[model samples]
Target: MPSSSGQCTCLRPFLLGSLLMLGFLLLLFTYINPNMDSPSLGMYFRPAPSCSHWANQDNSTLESDNETHHTTVLIWKWPFQYKFDSDCGVFGVQKCYLTDDRSIYNKADGVFFHHLDIHLGDLPKIPRPCFQKWVWTNMESPDNVPRKPWLDDLFNLTCNYRLDANIPVPYGYLVPRNSEDPDFQLPTKDQLVCWIVSNWNRNLLRVQYYNRLKDHLQISSYGKAFGKPLSEEDNKKVVSSCKFYLAFENSVHKDYITEKLFRPMSLGSVPVVLGPPRDSYLRHIPGDSFIHVNDFASPKELADRLHHLSKNPEEYMRYFRWTKESKMTISWFGKEHACRTCGYIQKHRKSIEVLDSTASSQPPHGLLTASSRPPHGLLTASSRPPHGLLTASSRPPHGLLTASSRPPHGALKS
Candidate 1:
């Protein structure tokens, strides 16, 4: 055995040597090792690039692509939610609108369906089976009542419409012209003036409501209040010359389809619609197809977007890409339908037949039980089908409702 002092001295050297070796190992692992599993021991680390760099790159790519491609548009007049016949329109015209039965045969321009449903809604529940489907929000009879209760049933039966698909029409309405000729002479600014023709007081009410827009843009207003109906020549000139037009509806309503949205696009003028959220309109129309009052954060913000478009003719003309391909028009309830959503319905004849078969095959007890239960969460808020029309009191929050629940239609008596 060693002396106490000697033993202590020996232990001190051993302990100190072990600690030094451990420290060396830690340092080596931390600074030099690339494959170290320990986070603190990793050899390389760096911060992410700034948002501005990513944004700039994205914007540059968008600008370059836009310059190279031509944009095409299909017009539809039916409500955005209705799915009807598919075989009646252009090859791709399944997505375009039709003015009349005759327009389906004329596809010299590109296809023009009423709306495009880019977002695919719930597959199992939507009445029409398609890879994609638009909503036909505009379909209304002469009395302005929706012609079909099936539409109401669809809204009541599915949360699928909202969750699976974005609204189909860009704006609730669109303007299209008869002539597809690109060289067609548009009206001059001096020849064209603001025009409104409606029996409803709401038309003038909106005029007064949005007077500031007229003043800022220096546009002139004329109609029954100002004078006679603008002549065809004058109307053509007015549309051709003016950069923008006011496409106010007689009444404010959700998913109300009107000619106001259509006439502006027809004449190559930007229509500024005064109802619903801009997103609601975009659900049906192409991106940047029309201007919505809701798009502006404020009235002043709306003025700014208008001013930008006014100054930039190229930007304003960009909207014409959808219209110029074909002078598509909206067709109502004929054998041939113009709306893409409607076409999708027509295309899936087999699936609809299957649904009918399944319903028929179900035992009477099961059918009765299913009918007694309320529509699934998907069908809430939407108008009741003919079989089960839920009253306004029964309408569910965030659920689908019939176009009848939509504004002007809602006001109409059932």
Candidate 2:
């Protein structure tokens, strides 16, 4: 109502002041609001709980336990020894010392030949019948051989361990032609038959005839006598290509589940197992994962099953699905930590009362006992120390001590 210029000036200052007040209010609201996102805020100033602190604490505890409970185990070196070795911290028996001399077996040969003896004599605590090797035919005579007593003693000492060493495959090896091809190359049906005819032995024929099978079914062998050894990678590829594999055991013994069964099953191939009763082998593997020769009344019956399975891809694929869905991870050899011998030792360490009378009932003469207070704090939780800390105890807490305490990894020596 006064001058137009005066009114315009009044509105300008008012608008400016209002905008400034609105910005100031917004800043104040942001500072007070707990839910507001502020990128500039320091982590320490934040009100939220620190998950990093908890994680660090957990990791620290694990490290501490690992530092405390380290153990070193001495093992006999052998090429065929598939038992766990503590030094490698891996599963499977590794060949440490190889030798050409047959007269005096090195640690490996000694362990291989006298496995039962050493185990029985309490010199070695490994499980019985540790490998899948053919016993020299000359040594098969049960006559006045010293090995008989050793076997008998081992049997008497530990009925808990299984001693069967069946060869699932009779000098069988796989070789893959090409892997990347959608239609991977496999041995032709005719080629397989021809190979079998050339390589079949009297023993092998006996197995075929005893099983009452067809002569027309395609079968082949990569013979050991011929020395056509398939490389490890080729073996894996062959398994992947094949729908079925023959898992022939070297010997027929009770409760022996060999790699012939394990490898094929692991590679998503259905195994045609030729060892032990179906029930015995199932103890080690998932039921329905394999087809046993004994399951079929005749060779035709077995062949029919195989043919039907091959034609029906859905059913055949089910076997592999079961393996995957179950998340089963099978190892051809036992883990370093899985030595039945070491397992026994760990179990008895706390329960051992006296060294003399408390010796393991099976093999290896050491007796362990559980004490309210173990010597050298071996049995106590304090035996474990922080990681990188020297002078830590070998005994680590196996379980979480409390909400405030946790054990470290690599803490135990096993």
Q: Which candidate is the best by TM-score?
A: 2
For candidate 2, which ten residues in a row score worst on lDDT?
132-141
In model 2, which runs have C-alpha deviations exceeding 4 angstroms? 1-72, 76-201, 204-206, 209-214, 225-228, 327-340, 350-414
Estimate the overall C-alpha local distance difference test score of candidate 1. 0.39
Model 1 TM-score on a 0 to 1 scale: 0.40
Task: Please write out the lDDT profile of model 2 over residues 1-414, one tens digit for every residue.
Answer: 599998998899899999999999999987776443235422111122233442244545534432343211123332234333343222222222222233221111112222322333433343221111111110111111233223321211111114221111111112222233233223322121111111334565334553455453765444343355454465565565577777765445454344456555555567777766888765555666777888878778888888787778678666654433332223212222223223222222212111111112213322233234322111122221111110112111121111111112211110
Backbone clashes in each candidate structure, one number apiece?
Answer: 68, 33
Q: What TM-score would each prediction reach against the true structure?
A: 0.40, 0.44
Query: Best-fitting candidate, measured by lDDT?
Result: 1
lDDT of 2 at 297: 81
lDDT of 2: 0.36
